[model samples]
Target chain A: MKQILAVDDSMSMRMLLRASLTAAGFKVEEAEDGRAALEWLDNNSPTLVITDINMPRLDGFGLIAELRARDRFRDIPVLVLTTESSPEKKARAREAGATGWIVKPFDPEKLAAAVRRVTH
Target chain B: MLSALATEPRTRRHTIMQGESEVSSDQRMVLSTVLGSCIACCLFDPTLALGGMNHFLLPTPPEGRGEDRGEAERYGIYAMEVLVNAMLTRGASRATMRAHLYGGANLHEGMRAIGSKNAQFARDFLAADRIQLVREDTGGVLARRLELQPASGRVRCRHVAEHVPDGRPAAPPPSSGHVELF
Candidate 1:
């Protein structure tokens, strides 16, 4: 099964994403923030990374930048799952090397489709 | 879920709907609401121990929208006014009142973040009314379940995830004419 790392500050959001991704047949891992996500990356490599932008310690942009600067994770796809829809934020995420962006209250099917687009 | 009530059996609970406001001096009454891309303002008078809350879907309704008084409550202006007036009527003094804000989650991506806009409007409205905003938890991608105890002016906010059931394709985004309330 494909492995995916999901990161968000909210527990409910993490639970919801886990449920959706697991139901779609992907093995999912969880992290609470960008810092924790980095720690997870230290020992494990997943097929793709899904993250939220606003967080307490470190953020999605920082995580993407960190991943891009590292040789081992440079080409890995990172999708931003957030509530931010501003054009400025989107452009910033793109410049930081995000693979895709999905807004909050996302449909499970659309999330799966986006995941498939980036991972496969 | 009235889990809070289970712990405190004496607490009275009430759910405030969209475009609605409730005020009371009853120490046992708890007003609650769930928000997604919406805003809820809780106002309280420290001196009088009277408080109220309002849930609004938008900052303003469209031009030439329905003139019914009920329709007006959906806008921030009316919602704030109604909440304040209700509190005042219940012996809350404006000079001694403060506000707390919650909700305003951006539930959808691609579309404009109406939640942010609503949060801004709420701040502006409170400032314009000269009400001090004591606390705020707003503007994110997750939904919130909020409970406000009017008399004690205590509030609890819990983040909740949005669930999209399997086999149910997401519904198409709605147009301005079809604004749905939560």
Candidate 2:
């Protein structure tokens, strides 16, 4: 089974992501922020990373940049799921190397479809 | 703003923040939000007496700006879709749907014209979907406080800014706080 690292500061959002992804037939690992996500990456390799932009320790942009800079995690696709819909923020994420962006309050089907698209 | 309407036994006022939405079938339910550059789209279906409102921060997602589709769903599109879907799930029909748009004020100087873009996007979306736009108050230099009674399809918009950038006093709200739908 493919594993996905879901990172966010909100416990509720994390739980929702876990439930949705698990229901979609993927194993899910979680982190409270980008820093913890990095720590998890030290010991595990997820097929993809889904993250929120505003987080403590490290934000989504920093996480994507860090991952892109590292040879080990360079190939993993990163999807940003955030409430911020500003064009500036989207461009920043793209510049930082995010594979895709999904706004919050995501549909389970669309989320699953996006995950499947990126993972495949 | 909603407290005044709470006198009714079944009336519930809900304040939605940015990137959020609410749908209700109760005739007394009132939805409210504060807006600057963000927009609030209130959609109502008179046939079912059902309605919903959504607040979104931007006009489009990354793909709208020529980027790859890449799993993007911007708040403007997402909020509208979600609200409309919720209303439909509750038995509302598209043919009877009506739309009201508020906000899209350019609250700051020398900034990107996000407010106008957001307002235009809402207009285009409603037009494309063949939804009737009954009313609109958009594109100014001040923020606003908006309230909508979904089932009645009545809306009240009040300027929240104390003064305009040109130093003129802001316009006063309607003497009557509410607009009754006949």
Q: Give lDDT tens digits, candidate 1, residues B1-182.
A: 11122234688898887777789879889988888777899998878877888888888766545233345456675567667656754566556888988877777886357889999988987776567888899988888888888877878888888641111111222211121111
Instruction: Summarize candidate 2's per-residue lDDT along B1-182 as a digit string, tens digits.
Output: 11112234667788876656788877878888888877888888888777788887776544334122322233576566556656755676556888888888988786459889999988877775556888888989888888888776667788876642211211221211111111
Among all windows of 10 consecutive residues in model 1 chain B, the one with the lowest summed lDDT is B173-182
What is the docking quality class of candidate 1? incorrect
Candidate 1 all-Cα RMSD = 17.4
Q: Output the number of the DockQ-best candidate.
A: 2
What C-alpha lDDT do the candidate models reach, one value each?
0.75, 0.74
Q: What's the distance in Å from true for residue A48, model 2?
A: 22
Please, what is the TM-score per model?
Answer: 0.51, 0.51
Name the runs in model 1 displaced over 4 angstroms: A1-120, B1-7, B66-69, B163-182
